[model samples]
Target: MVVDDDPEIVNLVHIYLTNDGYNVIPVYNGNEALSVISHHRVDLVILDIMMPDIDGMEVCRKIRKDNVVPIIMLSAKTEDMDKIQGLMTGADDYMIKPFNPMELLARMKSLLRRFHLFTQQDGDNSSHKDDVVQINDLKINKDYHEVTYRDSLIDLTAKEFDILYLLANHPGKVYSAEDIFNLVWNEPNPSNNTVMAHISNLREKMERAAGYKMIKTVWGVGYKIDQ
Candidate 1:
């Protein structure tokens, strides 16, 4: 989905994406974006930050409450803090205005590849691995891409879930911020702050219902889940 108050921006994105053989859903406002999302399955989103209602940040927050759709926020705001705020609000990526359509296309493809599950091999009758990964009261079902803590649903974005699953699957194994950045993001990130921010958000969400710490910070080392 491509959302922008500017018809020109939306139409431009729609044109480029459609020509690339993508089905484009162009939305003019945030409310309509939410409405369409609730009624349909959106693979990814390109959202404008400065909307008249709800805005992209708020829309991202709302979406993160339940859905884990990949979102790339767009803005003319060229401040570093603006970009940080967008990421902290659950955006998978952000881009400044006057961005090249080709760059956007490349980013879109990257995000889609990260977010979507790989298809099973055809004609292979091999049985699937047990998809459930349960630790204490935290249950992660890989098959359904669902996580529950103490029987309550824990709504996590895709990256968050991946991080949690990675730790939970290897309890007592500590992974440094750089290690996580490379493993989870599939790229080397210069700023450890990015990893830290996601870790902070993870703790805030899961520890609320957990009543005790789940992700432990090793300070000067890394992070881990106790066995």
Candidate 2:
């Protein structure tokens, strides 16, 4: 799904995504996007941050409330704050306007691939090994795609869950933003702001759940779940 007030962007994205063999749904406003998402099973969403009625941020937040679908936000704003805001609202990726179609396509592919990996993990358990990770009061059940902190369920977007699992899987190992992007999205040159936003969101949710900080930010380094 592509939601943007600009028809040109929608058409451009649709063309490229379709060429890559993805079924595309284009909407010109957030409300329409919401309606479509509510009624249909959307694989992914490309949303514009600025739109008439409801806006992309609200739409992203609303979707995160119940859905773990990957969302990539498009915006004309180049400021880090704006990009971070989109990510903070639960966007899996952020792309600036006048973006290279190839780059956008790459991001879309990466997100879709990661999303499917989790979905498949939820269904396939041929290995028959219990896939669970624990850190403090937090619990991550890889096989079920479930997370809980302090015995209370914590609803995380798929990417958020993946990142947390990665950090917890290697306790005390600091993962640089670039390292995390590469590991989680399989993208080597991802933006630091994007990673920061995700880390911020993860910290907020996990900390609230455990009543203390879980992931530590290493100044001038990266993030880690200390042992």
Candidate 3:
């Protein structure tokens, strides 16, 4: 799905993506995009930051409230803060305006591929031993991509679950922001703030459920699951 107020940009992306054999859904505004998403199984979203009615950031936040769908944001703003804000709002990737069509296509492919793998990893429950990891009262079922705290199920987005699983799988091993981004996202050069946002979001959910701290940040190092 491509959500952009600019018809030209939407058309360009739609044309190229359609040619690449993707079923593209193009929306001119954020509301339309949300409406469509509410009823459809959208794999990914390419959203514009500036729009009429609801902007991309709000749309991203709304979607992140319940959906873990990968979102790539587009904007003319080149500032690092803009990119960080977009990531903080739950965007999987960010693209500046005047971006290369081929580059966007490449990024779309990478995001889709990684997302597919993430979802696929949850299949085949017969191999539960390799898929499920337990630390204290928290149990992570990778086959189901689910988490449970003290025998109670905890709802988590795909990205959030992946981050938790990565840390809990290693227990006490600290992982830098770059390491987490590369391992979970399968993409490089994302801002550390992006990883920080995800970690903060994940920690909030887990801590709220567990009634205690789960992830610990090592000063000047990174993060690890509390053991």
How many clashes does each candidate structure show, in the order listed? 0, 0, 0
lDDT of 2 by residue, 1-227 (tens): 99999999899999998898989988999889989999999999999988978899999999998888989999999999998988899998888988999999887888887777656654546652557788767788876677887677898887898899899999999999999988887866677877888999999998888888889989999999986
Q: Would you give me the overall lDDT of model 2?
A: 0.87
Best by TM-score: 2
* Top lDDT hit: 2
Off by over 4 Å in 3: 121-123, 151-157, 188-190
TM-score of each: 0.86, 0.90, 0.89
Instruction: Please give the ranking of all candidate structures by lDDT, highest first, separated by commas.
Output: 2, 3, 1
* Alpha-carbon deviation at 219 in model 1, angstroms: 1.2
Superposed model 1: Cα runs more than 4 Å off: 118-129
Whole-model Cα lDDT of every candidate shown, in order: 0.83, 0.87, 0.86
| Cα lDDT of model 1 by residue, 80-165, tens digit | 77887887898877899999999899988977876565222333344334556788898876656678987898877777777888
Rank candidates, TM-score, best first: 2, 3, 1
Better of 1 and 2 by lDDT: 2
lDDT by residue (tens digit), candidate 3, 1-227: 99999999999999999999999998999999999999999999999999989999999999988787888999999998898788778787789999999999998898777666656664455777987899988999776667898889886656777789999999999999989988887776756877887788788888899888789999899999867
What local lDDT score does residue 199 receive in model 2, on the 0 to 100 scale?
90
lDDT for 99 in candidate 3 is 98
Q: Which 10 residues in a row give candidate 1 its minimum summed lDDT? A: 118-127
